[model samples]
Target: MKNVEPKVPLAVAGSSGFLPGCEGMRGAAALGVLLTHVAFQTGSVTESFWGRVWGRFDLAVALFFALSGFLLWRQHARAARGLSASPSTGRYLRHRIVRIMPAYIVVVCAVLLLLHEARGASATVWWANLTLMQVFVPYSLVEGLTQMWSLSVELAFYLLLPLFGWGLWRLRGEAARWRVPVIVTIAVLSLAWKYIPVPTADGVHHDNWLPGYLSWFAAGMILAEFATAPPPRMVRLARIPMLMPIVAVCAIGIAASPLAGPPGLVDLEPLEYAVKILCGAVMGYALLAPIVLAEPGRHHRILASPTALMLGRWSYALFLWHVAVLMVTFPILGVPQFSGYMFPVLVLTVVLSVAVASVSYALVEEPARRALLRWETARAERYRRQNGNAETATAATVTKASA
Candidate 1:
């Protein structure tokens, strides 16, 4: 496949691996999660029109999944094409672990120890979360950090991407185009699987499992193909600035409607849930595509700013620690239920969560990532040296025999 010149500058232009405007999108998504929880905690999310809008913000998780799929698929696509250096499975796992684990572990410890949020859970629960198996291990969610269930699904996607990419890359001749269809089939199957009744202690089904959310990830994968090796039609469509916003508004409206879901929707009839998932997936794509595929600097201008990027850099930490911050802050303020102090409480929680997230990122996440990367580099260098020495010795022996 020859490289196709992009019709316009991409988000990948100025930055090397980092997508330019995506940090803002991520920050916004993380804030959306915070806002949803805050609204519910403050007892205001169901009271007004704005509150209902904010309550629907749980869709942000779908956006996060889409972002993960798009970004990870792009990395794997580059690796498959021999364009990226760190393509080995070990290196990929190392990077994911170092990037995700440090801050996550810190938050888990804080919730269990200082906050005493999950004082009742057994040792197995702690181990399950530490190993990123919370979703699989029933009743393993950390007390206030229930949001980490998304991380479990994210981890599953990380594990599966290499195999998925390798399989697609190996397709030859007439079989190549089948790759997209195969992925689409899997997404459809996942939605069908969502309707299968499964026994749970609680009557309501927990859709946190990967199968239920695979469509959102697959939607991102489809966009990733467009970003990396777009078809002519996709390129033409991406150039149209008006298309994305119009699609976004329509998709959001549909997702917000009674047909798809109600505000603060959790448990839904199976058919309604499936429809809601589809609408959410479409909305996620609309929200993300403009940032990803649009002409550089023209679309998503507000999200392109430095402030959003900085917040996004800490978004992971913010997502991990925000609930714990809420759990602790509420008690110290001494107002148990909804009250006049609710506004102050919400403001204080945000400030505290940000402070904690900033410190966690600066001290733990960045350092751990750099250290592991440096170690991997050194290890690769040593292996190269050993291989070079063996090759040189073989050449010398061959010369001696010829002489």
Candidate 2:
């Protein structure tokens, strides 16, 4: 058998049979990001040790990348094999743009409008922020809602994925095989981060500085490719012996970091970054392993439950739209000072996230996905029919001519 065969996960393409644990992981990661957002917004980082811990939930950004990588690869590998598709990179790009834009536009505009009042910013600032280029162009966004950086990175990844996916798809020849290509690509991207002079505002520097977080995305893509491989013992070990404790430790670790303020003693930066990066990556693995490797069971019952699935399904919309919603609604309600009662803010965040997400997915992302499938499916059918007719017509015409 070819080396590529073993790399393909036994699960059929677009398998809804995913271990629900993955759905749980999505919700959990989204919530983790929400926590980090709240912590960042409050500038409560030094307020206490707990604040510090909550601060680290920001690592959910990594978890989000990893999970997206696994699923996108899983689906694309199964679907990208038809002539009509031309691999349909154009369609893929369109779908991504449409799926993400409506809600994103709404949210970015809402934030800008709020900022307009709060800081009297000019339309130029609004224009740059709305376009998502500010983060790359060296303009600092409004301080309060600058969490858009992660969104910027995610948008950048979305832009490159079809091209990246196409390149990897082309490597699926008989000789070099998928495994070599995947491993090589992963190693190269990772090493580039370690060595390449990635562009920055300063114009020349390696990716090792700042959150040159692209390496993690490449890691995620690598994981996605490998998920198709035959199950290894390590894959099983991840969910059982490995993943559980790792997630617990990460949760506890973030829970302990204090918010920013004088209430904190000396900073834990030395040990803090260490624990978060290490544990965060591990937690990301644990979250993904079950979905990628384990037998489908409602093992994460809390997550696999119907409500969570709905939330998970629309989580992206929910996340993109929630910040603006919260910003608009919270102040109007005269939100009380943060303290032990802060849980209410979290509740509002979840509710609004869920509401916005449900609307966005039903009206926007889902319809956009359906449109792509319909267009592509029709195009594929046409090509098949045209090819079959050409073959038959040639045979008939030749017989008459021969006669």
Candidate 3:
């Protein structure tokens, strides 16, 4: 894990329609969650200010799910590209495991090792975290690393990607041109459910719900398809109409939700998993809006501007490192005093997280990421070569028999 470069370029960089803004939105969303965790734990006046300004950055985690779906949607757009679905969904799953687990294991260990005093029972927390089932398990994992719930959900989603794709494919036939309506219907149903308030525990809050998020991935998959062959008219339309509603909904959701309750702003928790899923679906829409409505070009250069683009690129690694910095920072600041010294902690967290993440990209995630891709591609090329050789041998036998 020194500063090593990728041996092979990532497929998405040149091949997929994974334009810069998507990464920016994801990283920005991840950062928003980071701020929310900082605010929830340290309780600074500035954090309070932020919580009110945007309904707590915590709510944005749901948006991440939507972004996930939108990004993956591209893999499905193959028939549109004159190719069928890949023969093995298993390969995609293995890549996901390889991509996520390795760096997470490395970073979590580093954080726990660095900040032992900030939390208790490090051994047990580490165990729960490894399973990615810590959230469901009742016990807390990783000291003050409370932001892991969303990570657990994301891991679960990765497991379900193939199932999701199969279900989507079966819905209208993967090759059907009319599948757009099917996606819209599922998305709309999920969105409408957001209106119903979440039920209370002793009247307490449990913000996690399943239905609310599916729509986001579903939407992501839909758009992922477009990434393969983005429509011309949709790309050229005014301001990404597909994305507008989702943006509007998220803004409204935050505006309506409250933090630090007298009874805490009525939690949107009760609505069945469907509505939030719908919101996520819409989020998928917004993430892909710039590209789906049109291929990015001279007019769309704003979406990929250098400053914004750099932030997006570093966004994922930044997310991995941020919480640990906050945890160790809190004990130094003393949690009680964090409220008054909010400005310093916020600046410190951002600076350290970014620095650590830049290092993470250079050292751990990127290098391993490239090696895995190179290995996979090489295996694939060999398979093709072997298959072609067998076909040639079969043709030779037929020629000899005819003579």
Candidate 4:
């Protein structure tokens, strides 16, 4: 396909606006994650070549992490370059809390209260999952919410991102030159953290933690930095015909090989784990770079289409509800877990999950987000006005004393 540069340079866009097609990417990643879960539930992961491909769709989580990294870090990157100011720490945290926690809390409560398997869950389980701390505790993840491990990791990233942004901002004079390197170092440390021995209670997978997946996020952060200034080499690479799609295909192919480890719950050797991490980073970058860095093209237009944008808007709710929907789908279809009515079950689950997600978005997520954000804005404005009046009064008193 022919490549065109973005109409608005990423640096300018990074200040406040979204990179084009990002919503579509989010929608696609959410769907991929859903499909991966459904495949495992239906024993389709081990059924055939396509099944194996579906199993590897867990790579979508990497894409999700990467998208977060890129989008969230852009403003910070611009601030570091003195191009713009970052949000206040309090505002940032509030925004994140409002964006994620309300819908998540609703889902957690519904699952625990309504799901038969989760009905008898302990107080500790409720506490942990509600706070997104279930990944830290062993065997605390309840049924219909097992997929929340990644969400837990995402929350951890959200909490720490401001600190990371501050560290980047501190680079000052060296910020542009050192931004990518610093991020890469953190990513490397994250990978190395995987090899460090950490004691955990049985049933706890450290891989579910943010440290294990930080590299995937780092990949997106690096892309953010690159897109902000876009080196000539990167620009040329982006212009290459079919380059990104080829990279995406190759990365997926490699990730599907034995080197990336088995597509199951089996434990991975250190090497396999490392390979898998690398493959995920590469694949996520390949999938995202074009939309962020390259020009508008057929692929970009498709991703930015009205339908895809709608899916993206509801993606978070879709992700939150899909596993729960899948769990119930088994009973509704009279197909016991792993008994292989894969296709029909997938179709039904998608329909039901999408419907539920739409409702959740309309009735819960959007309203909550908008209300909180408006309140925050009004509070900030009032604070500014009060401060301005105080300063004006102080100046008047000084003038009168001088007179």
Best by lDDT: 4
* Per-residue accuracy of model 3 over 1-403 as CA lDDT, tens digit each: 6998665421222125456666666666777767666655554323244445433455467567766765555565564355455426777777778777877877766766666644345565678676666655555455545566677778877887676567666533444565566766765665555565656434222344344455656666666655554444444442544456567457435343342221112344434333434444444466456544443342235446776667677777777778887766766666553364666677778888888888887788788789899998999999999999999999999999999
Error of 4 at 216 (Å): 0.4
Per-residue lDDT of model 4, residues 162-228, tens digit only:
9898777777545587888888988887776668788888978787788889999998898888776
Q: Which residue ranges in model 2 land beyond 4 Å of their true spot?
A: 1-19, 75-88, 113-127, 143-145, 162-211, 241-243, 247-279, 296-299, 336-341, 381-396
Give the distance in Å from residue 191's predicted Cα in candidate 4 to where it truly belongs.
2.3
TM-scores of the candidates are: 0.87, 0.74, 0.75, 0.93
TM-score leader: 4
Note the Cα lDDT for every prediction shown. 0.74, 0.59, 0.60, 0.85
lDDT (Cα, tens digit) per residue for candidate 2, span 1-403:
6565455445422133365666767777777877666654445544566766666666787788767666655545444333122346676677777767766776666666554433666676667667765565554456434556667677777777776666666555342236435644554444334334356774222332334454445445555554544345645565575465567565546535432112322333423433444445555655566556555442655777887787778778766765555555456556633433346666777777778778878887887788878988999999999999999999999999999
List where candidate 3 sits over 4 angstroms from the true fold.
1-16, 44-50, 77-87, 117-124, 171-178, 184-212, 225-284, 298-303, 331-338, 388-403
What's model 1's lDDT at 9?
A: 40
Candidate 1: C-alpha lDDT: 0.74
For residues 1-403, write the lDDT of model 1, one tens digit per residue. 9999766543432112566577888998888888777767767656356666666677788889988888777665554445555367877788888889888888787787776767766898889888887877767776577888889889888888788877787642345455557777887788765578776554224577778888889878877665654455655665576786687667656666666555664666677678767866887777777666665445356787888888899999999988888878777888764444556777888899889889999999989988997898899899999999999999999999999
Error of 1 at 270 (Å): 1.1
Question: In candidate 3, residue 197 scores what lDDT?
Answer: 65
Q: If both were scored by lDDT, which would come out higher, candidate 2 or candidate 4?
A: 4
lDDT of 4 at 107: 97
Off by over 4 Å in 4: 1-16, 296-299
Candidate 4 deviates by what RMSD? 3.9
